[model samples]
Target: MQQPHDTPTLGKRAALSIAALGVVFGDIGTSPLYAIRECFHGEYGIAVTESNVLGVLSLVFWALLLVVTIKYLVFIMRADNDGEGGVLALTALAKPKQVRMGTPSWVLVAFGLFAACLLYGDGMITPAISVLSAVEGLGHIEPVFAPYVIHVTLGILVGLFLLQRHGTAKVGTLFGPIILVWFCVLAALGLPQIIGNPKVLSALLPWHGIEFLVENRAHGFVVLGAVFLVVTGAEAIYADMGHFGSSPIRLTWFAVAFPALTLNYFGQGAHLMANPQDAFHPFYAIVPHWALIPLVILATMATIIASQAVITGAFSLTSQAINLGYLPRLRVTHTSSTHIGQIYVAPVNWLLMICTVGLVLGFRSSSKLAAAYGVAVTATMLITSILFFVVARKRWNWSLPAAGALTVLFLMVDSSFFVSNMTKIFHGAWFPLLIGGVFFIVMITWEEGREILGAKIQGLTESLSAFMDQVLADKPQRVEGQAFFLTGSYDRVPMAMVQNMRHNKIVHSEVYFLHIRIEEIPRVPNMEKIELERFGSGIYRIIAHFGFMEEPKIATILELCKGLGIEADLETASFFLGREKLILGDKPGMGRLRAHLFLFLSHNAMDAAGFFDIPSEQVIEVGAQLEL
Candidate 1:
């Protein structure tokens, strides 16, 4: 995913493809549990006659073909930014190196950011619906189990969130095998019904879907809001492309996931056509009585794996946002030492848990939650299409006509789903909009506040060259030990250095100004990470380059410096970090309300020593008040 490391042998690709089943396909794989039932028995129910059944199945088939298969796997996945895919990664790809007025880049970037925020909405809804739908199967086992569904769901969700700190490495090994079994069961359960009625196979033709929309007119159009659920996790496939590489994901999809999903959906339609009375739960109705309990248990495990993938994705997304300066610093714990992508964001995990539990209590059924599912996904899909258009033009250098043509095709599909989803705004679709709006505001505020603060500091500070020239000319008294001043800008004197000169009145025998710069790419190779410059008189400047996915550690930086010929003993060194307090200056560009919010965020932000993993006893905090 992070650009090709090597040409993987066939055996390696096969293993990665299998492992990807757990993480990459889990969300889409679980769609069969509720997608079919929601279409026929949901708020926009259509009749389950043979024609209607095949028609609906046809729509699902084509949507999978057009959106997930053609659009994402073929086109959008190719827009990966250095082999990283996702709205945020795509945004970085589409963002122009230079800003120009009247260009559409700004709009594209803004839309992409909002789309990224909407994924949080997806994060909250997916687990609620997936786990809730699976747990509801208990009712099939016994009528008495229906009453305890909510309690059981809440308990499962709580337990899941609580277990995040322990990491996923322990259970991750079982994810691929369990999801494989779940998909197999999905195929097996639906196959008999499908085999019994070959007439349902006619749904593979495109005309059935068109006739479905024409026969029902506007009613069928609205039903698309439900049908959109089939491709709800398509974005996740693109997002996780960086995890297993696109080759493995593409191979697994067509070879394993696609066939099973296609068969199960056809099988469900066949079952529905024969026994329309069981339309409320055709998925469970297709299963043999003897396999019901085991299937439900397997289904529960599969859904949990689905939920776990989304939860961990939220953690990884949060980490990206933090490193990219879209969000404030939060505690990020790397769960797997071997797997760079396996991470834990506790704050994000707990917040998602609270929302997931609340959603289950509010909707109380997967059918109602289905009303809220597609709006965020469709909007995100639309945004991804727009961004992909930009990347095709700017990065790929494709012809304008060619890029526009493909985008138009994608837009037509995305627009239809988004407008259809708009009809459900009153019926619980408002949840994602409200949540995404708040997150968008926070992201915009954080970015704007950082820029304003940087400008303010720039106006009050001296250039590094000027400060170094003056210090060498003055020849101030020097101390024995080394001093490393953590700085934000490479070519400006750190606030801590300025304050140290004003208050402490002496320079150390060895002075190193360190700045950590996060690059847009997922990772910066270690060999190119450290940039050093000598300013004479034992004073130096060290600029450390980190990728958005990499965490900066001061200890590691020092160790790397030692290898780069800057010999300094750790025991005799002290790290100086600037601590800023925000105050509204006369030229405060931010509105009063946003300024206050930024103040609160800055006040509670993780300190430099903690975030950088510096030794506590060796860190010295230098404080200054900054007007924003």
Candidate 2:
């Protein structure tokens, strides 16, 4: 039998590239439906004259080339942390090795966390906008369908989200074939328009775009808010890099997605140049009349795929957050037996569905939701640029001049987009800002609160050496079976062990202090998983390491302990755990309001036994109260 790694060939890579098409390009691929239309008819839209149309098209061309093609695909994708790419993963890599180094680490961490929060906002807006844009194409088929656009959009979105529980593996096989056809249709529909008026090709040069901005400086600046819509989903390419390696993502983008999108965009521009009256819905109008209805059906399917990508991304990000201790533990169900990353988070799923539907009902149109969409993505892009700068300078050992130069260019572009989208704050961009802000608060509160609670609790415990000597000084009744106490701090004795000795006055013949450590990386090999230290008097200390990508399972760790010469039986051994009930104090540490909030979070967090996969029948929970 051939090993998995030895089975690779060119065909496998090509297949992975095809699979990349369905999830990675869904959002940006659907941009042609409204990107060109928004340029001339959105809130900040300019006139539809020949010069203005070519100017806008020129700007779109370069934005895609520089921002998505060069900035992300060429540069940012090179900054992956241990094969994991995302705002959080990049932040973890960028964190300074020395705590006392220049530019405090907390500042970089804060920026990264805020950026992750904004992505949640993006997750909410993507489905609403992408699905609505696809369904809105129906309005062009018949004027009578205008009233039912929202109804149809909501139905499609609800049905799409409801299917998330079934896992993406089932339908993922069709994604490549479906999106492959969608891109072909985009190219097929746009080729004729591009050929009809070769003048649209003139917009390819940067001078046309620069001239447009110079001719209409103030209006052009505002128009960038609309123009930014074309590259809204570019970050998904980077966020999903771990799903399909950078090779496949890059090949798919350069070969298929980028070209099809550019042709379609230029085609829409050429169509407008020839017939300026079709500015209302130029994308569908460019299609042949007989193919309009079938095109709408295809577009709807593409949009659902786009929406599915974001929903799936939200689930993955939440799982990372839970494992990293930035959020409360929620019940995570692995939807696939083969792929550990294929997970269904019910709370995140339902919450996103509710918010996505509410956004559709509230905004009522893709154009309106577009106003709220760019801010989150732009903010995330800006933060990614910043984090990338740090990683380039610190991790890659790049010289100051080289790192500073490229980062400054990226920052300048990102800041321009950020400022342009900032103009729409009052228009409708407040929705994402509000959502990101709420999530940011919750994440920060959880992180900071855990640190303070850990410190306070650690202060109350004695050192492990001292506790061991005390136990030696006053010997207790020794039982036959082994006992394992799960603890957070390895330096201090676990509260469960202390309470057990105080009440029962007995210790197991073999007592093990097991500390489960979640590392910053994605996965840790099983060969390096367990570290054992035997203290005197039949007391042993074991530290088990797991990556953020691995679910911590106590039973697995216990089974592995046999290799280290520790005798254990799952049927007879007992696992001890501490359950803390947080009490809010009138002190000024976290303040009363935040303290009470942490208390509530602690009370509802998943118990350790369930989260660590410890069997309930072989567990003992000792309850205690801690004041914060």
Candidate 3:
């Protein structure tokens, strides 16, 4: 069941464009802080020569052009699931069905879920690293403030996390103008150096990238560890595409953000080449001393916006995961209806706050945190590219040769970055890997637990209509109104429904066997609404279709059903929901302790009346058997 409210239109295209510029561009916008500097001057405590600088800059530029502008913005974003984008949205469009009996879609979903979990690790690290790096600029001004850098960084991060509940639309409004000014300032400071050393422009040529790789060989490959920082937020672009349509994101990048970023990076490279001896930060060297404070403030704002984007992304991803059944349903609060993307999750927000602050404290400098930031982002990107290829050929009906050629080129570039970042695993990159591993375990456990429970229910379930006939024949009990039975499967109704009719001496004029299926797509078409099949003797089997992006509201659908000529009165309908209380008598695979704990947790879960949007007055709960 879904509610149809007025889809509040975002202002005009221009305002929507500005909003997109603010919210969607944060990840890519903050890259100028360290992308070029780290590539030229290795974060691994080594000096990078002039030759490697051109090559690294070339790699960053080309990676953005090929991967971000071409692959995602131009192509992948078009593969939206009813105007939504992301792994889950894509999965919905694909409609991945189980290949075998034991095999559930959860197995396939785990891959994307793992990627989502890894993004959480990235969300935690991005803020810590981005803010710390910007604040570390204070060190260049005076060494005395260095001691309190971590303290200030942590405080700002904590404040940002707390503000998430307030919704980003208020704070987010300033992001576009702030980032616009920051990029302009970035290019303004660096333009003079680019004009002086025009040869640095030669880095734009593809051969320069090749030459750097040929000459530096080992070091050139490792440059990816740092180059990855440039595109760390590339996935955010695709993930946030649903917020502001695909066209806006494409136009925003090619028209505004792209050229500004390129010039700024070139400016940074030009500054480094001209004044190799200057101890001044090349990023700040372009700016005058009088504007240093203002520049730092702008940088801080941009970084905060970047952190906020990832935080919002985590919330959206968690919401999607819950709908897809990879994770248990957690409490979700919609921050804004006008902007479906604006959401806040209590557990996710708090956990991110703790992890982010811990990272800031542990790795006080952005340089140290940078090593861990790119790995999770790059790994997710590579995985996305792989999935994109499958989608392009199989789903999009693209020719194999064309898809293969496009996929191979992107994979080489992305895989190189992934391997490059892999070298930094021991040097703090292991943090994201550790987080991803832990999250993967949680996803798998929850998924496995559901499978076992589903199987247990399947074995115990009895045919509702047949059992009803037998109960009526034996007991002849009669009651008023319609009875709705909830079951885990659509194939057969639960035994509880039959037992309740027989033992409790209750019967209704009509019995509706309801099966609610949540689809992977963000929205369901009107044609695929609710299907009703009458099973004789006033027994009707109703199957309701709900999209992953939709919140299931059974009452609302029943109201909608009135228009289709099937009258369902919620006030008179008695809702019968089965509750499986597990008895832990030594389950074979999941040991007694784990089963007992799982059973305890499952038993205490929110009742179906609230979860499924049924009125409390019309609800009837039946406790059933569960062997674990």
The local distance difference test score of each candidate is 0.87, 0.86, 0.75
For candidate 2, the per-residue lDDT at 80 reads 78
Give the CA lDDT, 0 to 100, for residue 604 in model 3.
51
Ranking of candidates on TM-score, top first: 1, 2, 3
What candidate 3 gets wrong by more than 4 Å, as runs, is 1-11, 45-48, 93-95, 99-108, 277-280, 471-475, 566-573, 590-606, 615-618
The alpha-carbon deviation from the true structure for residue 399 of candidate 3, after best TM-score superposition, in angstroms, is 2.6
- Could you tell me how far off, in angstroms, the CA of residue 472 lies in candidate 2 after the best superposition? 2.1
Q: Is candidate 1 or candidate 3 better by TM-score?
A: 1
So what's the TM-score on candidate 2? 0.97
Winner by lDDT between candidate 3 and candidate 1? 1
Question: Which stretch of 10 consecutive residues in model 3 shows the poorest summed lDDT?
Answer: 1-10
Please report the TM-score between candidate 1 and the true structure. 0.97
Query: How far off is residue 18 in model 1, in Å?
Result: 1.4
RMSD of each: 1.7, 2.2, 3.3
Candidate 2 lDDT (Cα, whole model)? 0.86
What's the candidate order when arranged by decreasing lDDT? 1, 2, 3
